[model samples]
Target: MSKKDKNSSNSRRDFMKTSATALAGFYIVPRHVLGGPGFIAPSDKLRVASVGVGGMGGGDVRGIYGTGKVDMIALCDVDDSRAKQSVEAHPKAKYYKDFRVMLENEENNIDAVSVSTPDHMHAVIAMMAMKMGKHVYVQKPMAHDIYEARMLTEAASKYKVVTQMGNQGSSGDGVRKMVEWYDAGLIGEATKVYSWTNRPVWPQGIPWPEKGQTPPKDLDWDLWLGTAPYKDYVENLVPFNWRGWWDYGTGALGDMACHIMEPPFRVLGLGYPKSAECSVGSVYVGEFQQGYFPESCPPSSHITLRFDRPGKEDLEFHWMDGGIQPTRPEELEANEQMGDGGNGVIIEGTKGKMMCSTYGINPQLLPTSKTKDINVPETLYRVPKGDQGHYANWVEACIGGYGSKEFDLLSSPFSVAGPLTESVLMGNLAIRSYDYRAPRKENQNQFDYPGRGIKLLWDGENMKITNFEPANQFVKRQYQGDYSL
Candidate 1:
């Protein structure tokens, strides 16, 4: 464009990169021109923006905008082909392939951002926006690694920006009901919990595609790679299927555990795990031996985590993927579904077991009829519209400003979500640890899986694996290119 616009683009990066307080003056205009945060003329709307407007991210934007509560100011995605639909739908919103540039140029115009990128890129993108004092609503897992999760959890309050993770079930009435049930001791202090999902439903337990593909002209390959290692474009890795790879995705646990396990986290008021162990499915590449795919996640895994409680012994939590299910609790009717067909959660207490389907949508106590027989007074405020109101909840929270009741009332703000995501991903770490490989010094042609089948102890406050030193490296990955968090 014009000379003025070109200069703005060049300096936009630095402008948004600066501290939030330094950028506050630029936002006074929305007030000066339209009045303050409370001034809603039916013309006023939350100035919403997004990083990834393809896949589930597109759904996030559509839902928020569907509320007719926000102005779709800008959209950013590295792949134009993936973003085509959103661009067409929000034609008036400016577009960019790089989020940094979008933030630079649109910081003054954007009040909040939805970060719905790949699991690896979530924390960095959200951190940048939050540092600039923009509220953030990020998709689940909140972060790809434990370190990133901890940082984002802390950044939310330090920046004083409204934040929510896109684990919609966090707002669902079912989870709140479970919380109420647990509070009334209906389950008699949950000691063990299990959550499982049927996923990878994408590919896993395989080597990367041996050959590279021609990068589509519309896709900015480098920008799409973002914090991931620079590699030649691989076929079928984009649009989806990245979930099975470690560099970009958090595997099935990251993909679905947030929805499946959120209830237990809330019900028990859980914290970081003290130790984790896992067993994974194997891929038979030959007649005799199993293949080890370090770059890719295992096809399935069963991970167990123990969390120490104050007065009690500890909470044991189990996570399973790839359709694996825990033993059927004896209390349930044989015909009753275990975990909503292929996906579900179960909490076992001293007195009984409680179960639910995915996203904590359905809650039924074992022996089938306890839900109605034992009623606990509602203590928690229910999110309006249940899970469907998740998007609007953040929209209103952003409008109310951080520290307001709406902000404090968020169901999955980073404060709560970050720890929850970290706890969920700890399972992945144990899974990954089971597959950790090292080149054998004595035999150059072969590798060794030294981390397998070990109960890796964790030191949560420090974000370390105290018992398994080799697995500690996965806690925080080194960023390629210029990105850092």
Candidate 2:
């Protein structure tokens, strides 16, 4: 209503329209820099809009706002019930049920975007924001598919925007310390790595519900489905259980590997796996019948990924989920715990071994006694507040603008996260391919599962499976309806 307020609103609208038409390839400058002459200053807050604001997303909202240097300009979510807390927390922010509407209306008003939606929707939302020249902070497992991860990585570079993945562990001190010890030759050359988790605290390895229920009044089921195939609403599918499904979620591997496997990936400087193989647990529906559900992720799985190390022998990495764990090390005491009892990682080398829990916490040498005595120098810079600082790190970097000192020091920039995500998704790729079946040539009634009992050779540069032609379908999923990268 005030004269200054109206003028300020008009200026923002004008700038957004002009930028959309004329600044297609230009980097978005800091908001303070947009003010002419006497109005220029560096104290302006970084304005942010968030797409998902419940569960893990709510945590992201609070973390970024806690930085005291950001303005929560807008919020969007498909389910109002899930987003209640976030909407109430930031009453000043405009709220919308559709992200596309939120972005179109607020594009000029916000400086950055925080994408905390489900796995499948992450890529499309993040890509649209990057194309609009807004900095982005996407949650872990950067994308649902390897191709999406690669595209997001390339978009970050092309758009020249500051970017960070939501794997808080990437900014933690545990990983940095492990990096230092590995670099100091304390562990010699890491030859084998194992990471495990107790996940699927939700349902998996099951058939789609034979029945569908009416969606809740507050939930827009269609928008929530987004890129996933259209399906009738089912109970217990929203909020959290979706992680077990193949369409909307990436199962346990995508849900937790970004946090659990990050330490080894960072310590060893890993890239795409040269080959992948996997075996999955099965459920029985009757005395003689095994449950075959392609729509859902398997109940439990053990994935082996082979990574080539230039001149040295290939590194063997193993990932286990559904409460599975690796063999106990001889160096560890009989009574000692491995990986905090539930989730953990073990990096074995020629000389010694080291271990850590999820989020790279509580890193220790195999002997445990040697943990305190080792003398590896702390060479890597520790992010302030460690993992808890993840959100603030991105906020400060956005305020500092792309290519600034703050941006350069980001912990999980897409350049690092993209490769990490691709490696993580490879485990899922192998798992899905394990169930690929074909009809027998002689006996039409009998099926020959060709994808089973085989190692899929990978050509990382081309993002394709060199040996198994059918397995390549999982590389980049087909989008449903109008949703796309």
Q: Pick the candidate with the highest lDDT.
A: 2
Residues 1-485, candidate 2: write the lDDT tens digits.
12432343233222211211232354546645575321112477888999999999999999999999889999999999999999999999999998889999998898889999999999999999998889899998889999999899899989888899999998888998888888789889999999999997999988889799999999999999999999999999998999999998899999999999988988877777889888888788654235646788988899999987766899999999999899999999999999988899999999999999999999999899999998875666667899998887788778766765566567888877888899899988887773434443433222233565799898887899999887888999999988777
lDDT of 1 by residue, 16-109 (tens): 1222233233332344565544332333588888999998989988998998889899999998888989999999999999999999999889
Off by over 4 Å in 1: 1-43, 287-289, 434-446
Q: Please list the residue runs of candidate 2 whose C-alpha ends up more than 4 Å from where it truly belongs after superposition.
A: 1-41, 287-289, 434-449
Q: What does the lDDT come to for candidate 1?
A: 0.82
lDDT of each: 0.82, 0.84
The TM-scores, one per candidate, come to 0.89, 0.90
How many residue-pair clashes does candidate 2 contain?
Answer: 0
